[model samples]
Target: MAKYLMLKHYRGAPAAVNNVMMDQWTQDEISAHIQYMNDFADRLKEAGEFVDAQALAPEGTWVQYGGEGRPPVTDGPFAETKDLIAGWMVIDVDSYDRALELAGELSAAPGAGGRPIHEWLELRPFMGEAHTITE
Candidate 1:
């Protein structure tokens, strides 16, 4: 099976149908959203196609390596409008179509009113050790 990376972007995509931010949601809504995500992962695990998944904290810092013995350069976590990756899931699937199907399901996760979010997801295939076509 080929591995694919499913990327959920918080920024850089058109706004979701249910665009209200999490901070605006009720506590129960937030809990439900979290539960839905957990269940999704569990379902994938049962199917044996799940490789790995992770959610990133809203806050992040950019750091660049400095020359030897010097301190690294740090940048802001960035504003809400800046590019922010919400999370990712790596799946080992039988075909490209299967990968896309799973991504569509993920994009349908519940939103504020418990309705489908219809969010956008970026899908990419992993290139394991391989030589260029020219080779």
Candidate 2:
């Protein structure tokens, strides 16, 4: 199986996701979202294509390489970048088409109002030395 990366991208500035908003959601709504995600994961597992999946924290830190003898410099939680990645999921699939099909399904994840978020996801194929051919 080949691995593919599904990257999550947000459309606008990072808004504060408040606990109050989450708390205010109807129980059924939350349950439906959970079911959707769970079902998707279960499908992947049943197909034996599941490798690993994870959600990432929003906060990020930046590091810079210094001169040859100097130590690396680190900086924090930069907020200026507009294209900050929200999260990612990695999957092992048989082909590029299969990876794209999975990504399309994940992009339809339910959000507020029981509607699909329709968020954009970047799909990238992982390359490894094992797949290379040397003549």
Candidate 3:
């Protein structure tokens, strides 16, 4: 089975059918949305396709290694980071088709008004060995 990374972006993607932001959603709507995500993951786990999943905090820091033993450089809370990744799910599936199907289903998770978000999920396949450069 091939492993895929399913990325849920907060921005930088096509607008969802239900474009209402999560911050504008009601308490019940948020609860329902969370429940849908949990249920989806549970189903995948039962099917043995779920590797791992987690929701990310909006706040993030960009870090880079400094030369030698110097402290790591840090710069964050940047405007460019507004296109933040909301969360991710790792799945092991039989084929690319299956991975696409799963991502489509995940994109249907409940949003505002308890309707399907119809969001766009970025599905990326895990790469194998690196190839040597040829002249």
Candidate 4:
């Protein structure tokens, strides 16, 4: 099986069909959205396709390598940044087609009004595989 990364972005992606932002969603909507994600993960686990997943906070600090003997330089979580990753899921699947199918399903996670978000998910295959670009 090949490993793939499924990236969910907070910004930079096209607006979802259910464009209402999470902050504007009701508490129950938020809970349902979380439940949908958890259920999806559970399904993947049962299928032996799940590797890992995580959600990220919006607050972040950009750290860069500093010259020897110096601490890493840090920068703002700049509000002007074009994109911010909201979360990611790693999956081991039999084929790229399978990965795409899974991502499409995940993009349909419920959002405002208990409707599908229709969010775009970025999928990237890991290196060292024959099907990967590095090959």
Best-fitting candidate, measured by TM-score? Answer: 4
lDDT of 1 by residue, 1-135 (tens): 899999999788788888888888888888888888899899999999999998898788889998899999899866855678888999999999999999999988888888878888899999976657854
Q: Model 2: which residue pairs collide? A: none
Candidate 2, 8-125: lDDT as tens digits:
7653434423212445667887888779988988998998888777776778778899879999998977677777676677899888999999999987877667776566678988
Candidate 3: count the clashes.
0
Candidate 3 lDDT tens digits, 1-135: 899999999878899999998899999999999898999999999999999998899888889998898999999779865488989999999999999999999999988999999998999999856668856
Q: Estimate TM-scores for all models.
A: 0.85, 0.74, 0.87, 0.90
Error of 2 at 16 (Å): 18
Instruction: Give me the overall lDDT of model 4.
Output: 0.94
Clashing pairs in 4: none
Candidate 1 structure lDDT: 0.89
User: Local distance difference test, per candidate?
Assistant: 0.89, 0.76, 0.92, 0.94
- Worst lDDT run of 10 residues, candidate 4, spans 126-135
> Candidate 2 — which residues are off by over 4 angstroms?
10-27, 66-71, 130-135
Q: Is candidate 3 or candidate 4 better by lDDT?
A: 4
The alpha-carbon lDDT assigned to residue 52 of candidate 1 equals 96
Query: Residue 81's C-alpha lDDT in candidate 2?
Result: 72
